[model samples]
Target: MVIAVRTKNTQTVSDYNCNGRHVFTQTRELERPLVGSILQSMWGVSPTHLTWSALHNSTLVDYSWSVGQTPFGPFSEMSTLSFAQKDAARRNVLLTSLNYSISSAIDVLDSVAAHGGERKLLKHNQYVEFVQRWSLFKYKLDKAVSALSHFDFELALYYLRSLDHDLYGAHAIVYHASQELEASLACFKDPPFPWATVSVYAVCVVAFIYVYMKRDKLFRNKRKQF
Candidate 1:
């Protein structure tokens, strides 16, 4: 359902074809990833997660990496830092690294929920946050995948980059989860409660109750409606 027709402007604008599928404008650097994203969708892999895995794993191998020519320039290369920047007002990154991070985190969210990972962080509200944000993320991801499938790279990139705010928020949740886990483990290893101090508190409570009852009765007998 994809078509490639020449327009008078020669700027290569993409839009819907006769069969209702998107058409490709130009074969930019995003073409391969777009096709790969479509294939990943068919194969039941998340496009965002796949992007994360590629970037994350690649970074472990090489700290410095860059993608091909973006709207910025052919010489300009996209990186995780560049993609995750908040000031990208014009043309956003080739791929949204933060968006991918959230997608990757959502995949493991079940594990975190099952093992009290989120609970340890005391971020029960994040469950709701994740659910709502993830729903939106999925919607955008679906649109991106669809756009990519029909070779609408610009729209696909737009949708992918649009998830930055939600993804950045997700990063905070993940950070808290890790911090909570560490704090709990560290604190749990401390010495047991001071039983001797607790016994002292118990005796004080018993003595206070005895004195109060005796004083109340003495006062009641003397103050009888006088």
Candidate 2:
């Protein structure tokens, strides 16, 4: 994530009447990390090849010196100074906004994934649609990152802004499906009690108690046969 800028100076000299005149000029080169190479190694394709190569191989800043007694002059009066300042301000604002949007999107995604009973409650087609939407969301995020790598802030913002509808749709699908599932589960109630079976059991218990109490009188003549 670090950008390195290098400056090289070239000087010209001339001699006239025992006095020497010297002119110094500078050129700037930008060096970014070998991200494309790393990506190529990992994924077998270099997404940033053209952009990184163009940025690294081109001279970002070039300056020329006019013929004068003094080589250095006031920098505040430069014609492009105001434009550079404005560009920097705009870039800063865009970066801030992008950061907030990305974080919010991630939060939304996490909330959807963490919802309870999403798998059991959602139908096959609904789950499939959710998966497709998630894939699309991630693809857009990747494209936004690619745009950012090339410093295309506006394009990156556009991609980030477009994710809202998909995100909300996914959330609504899970929420409504879970609600329906809960409602269906709530419809089941316990069956009524078996009062007839309980009454038969009570009669059997009373008959057993009566026989136990009369057992001695019923066996009074049993010893006469011996």
Candidate 3:
């Protein structure tokens, strides 16, 4: 059971009422800086003050879940089991998503390497940066896995999300490099072999040789005529 309470001032609140459901209350002030700080601490990202307003707006919707009409057993035991099942489900989802992302990134890296023109396509500085970013991405993924193993889902999630920037930059670099390589290749043209010119030259040489070989007979006739 989840109960959300919104109050203007803590001291002036007279009624704390929820319809007989157990309350797991976490209180936070509606102040922007505090909310931003909390978000930064949790997600390792600094969000704008508008995040607080968005959060406030989201609280307007009441959401509930059914734990399958509580079995005829001890209430506490059933509640504990339900919580455990939910936690396991959450962990499974996280693991699946992390694995998918890792595999996709690996495929992208493989494609980049397989393009076979790293030296021609990417500058030395770009190659260095790509290597560094790839290493960092792997390191973060390792950390995320470690965190997951230790049941630190929040940390794992944060690590997983944080790699987006590096991954995107690497992707952009590869994409642009591939585009440049393709453009350069497209602009290149192999001049056709000059077969006709070579044939003409060969004919001229043969004619000159024949004339030379027949020169004695031609000169004898000319002398007779003289």
Global lDDT of each candidate:
0.53, 0.54, 0.61
RMSD of 1: 20.8
Model 1 segments more than 4 A misplaced = 1-103, 106-122, 181-226
Query: Considering lDDT, which of the candidate structures 2 and 3 is the better prediction for this target?
Result: 3
Tens digit per residue, CA lDDT, model 3, 1-226: 2233556544332233335644332233334334334434443332211123375664232222212322111111122224444455567767876987788788767877788755665789889888887888888889889999988888988888887667877888888777766434456689999999999999999999999999999999999999
Model 2, 150-183: lDDT tens digits are: 8787897788777656666777777677566543
Residue 71's lDDT in candidate 1: 23
Q: Using TM-score as the measure, name the better of candidate 2 and candidate 3.
A: 3
lDDT of 1 at 9: 54
Those runs of model 2 whose alpha carbons end farther than 4 Å from true positions after fitting are 1-84, 183-226
Query: Which one wins on TM-score?
Result: 3
Task: Sort all candidates by lDDT, best to worst.
Answer: 3, 2, 1
Clashing pairs in 3: none
* Clash pairs (backbone) in predicted model 2: none
After TM-score superposition, the amount by which residue 121's alpha carbon in candidate 3 deviates from its true location, in angstroms, is 3.5
lDDT per residue as tens, model 1, 1-226: 2233343553343543424755444444454444434333433322222234464564232212222322222222331223322223222333444356556766557556655665554466876786677677778777877876665667877777776556656656665665556433444577999999999999999999998979978788889966
